[model samples]
Target: MNFLTIFARNLKQGPQTEAFPLGPAFTPERLRGRIEFNADHCEGCRICERVCPANAIRFAKTPDGMTFDCWHNTCVFCGNCEFYCPTDAIHQTNDWDLSHVNADKFDMVEHGLIPNQKCVECGATALNTAPVIKNAKPPLSAEEYTELRARCPKCRAKYLKNRKVPA
Candidate 1:
């Protein structure tokens, strides 16, 4: 077509670009964006840290407990850490709005803490994470699960071992 004809046709159609800043931007359902960490559901396995290709995730021992940090600046949004986490503690949210000034670059981090708790039976301190109980015979009752959560690893194993299985 001629330039004038093509220009007329283009003018008839509205702007094809997204109206972001004036309207909500398009976000896909599976868009890999910001990282989120939930210490409560974490198993303290540190698999997320090892799987992160960008080395954005780090775990450190602190006086209070273990601390988790994921730097957004360094993260490539590969979702490897989220996929490798066995307990679903790490997740990638759809909020991809990471625009920030130079001053705020260092603050773009997702942080979490797995606090230490005293074992009810052994008086030992351990991370307050959900116990990994995949092989409980008839499934643990709420009370039994609560009791299991209150002990150390060794005591929890013992409790599970001594549990009377129903016929």
Candidate 2:
């Protein structure tokens, strides 16, 4: 209980913590660490971004395409993105060592050129998302759905404007 005794004991025990950053880092099983996005499997539903509690997930629709970004600094690692991803594109990895001096290290972003389906009517780019085009098979016939999927935004607007609805 003496100060000298305590100091001696501390000296004898040395460091009680693991030497991380120099040695192997350990993470717990099922550690919701970093968010991983698989663009191949992603349907761009934006559901993950919508369901994120921390607002760490962000989506931007640019001229090039839609980009999804996740910030580790803002993320609480709750795995909400993974849970809400309808396409199973988002995943929680076991890499919990997120420490870094540079703030840019915390950013995870995925960007790709928009997959445009040409409008069958005018050969213009279709405004529908990939998932929408893929899932548009049941109600509309195959040919009609294909044409609809290829319809451009301008053409769609014009069609809607000229459409006659029965009272």
- Writing each residue's lDDT as its tens digit, candidate 2 over 1-167 gives 59999899999999889887689767788887878877656667788878899898788777655666787778898987888777677899998777776756644443333454667678865435433434332344555544544567677556444545445
Candidate 2 Cα errors over 4 Å, as ranges: 1-21, 103-122, 126-167
Identify the leading candidate in terms of TM-score. Answer: 1
Alpha-carbon shift of residue 121 in model 1 (angstroms): 0.7
Off by over 4 Å in 1: 1-14
Which pairs of residues collide in candidate 2? 119-150
**Clash statistics: count for each candidate:** 0, 1
> What shift in Å separates residue 33 of candidate 1 from its native position after superposition?
0.6
Q: Which whole-number lDDT from 0 to 100 does residue 29 have in model 2?
A: 80
Record all residue pairs in model 1 with backbone atoms less than 3 Å apart, i.e. clashing: none
lDDT of 1 by residue, 1-167 (tens): 59999899889996889989899999999899999999988888899889888899999999899999999999999999888888888999998999999999999999999888899998999878778877778899989988988888899989999999989
TM-score of 1: 0.88
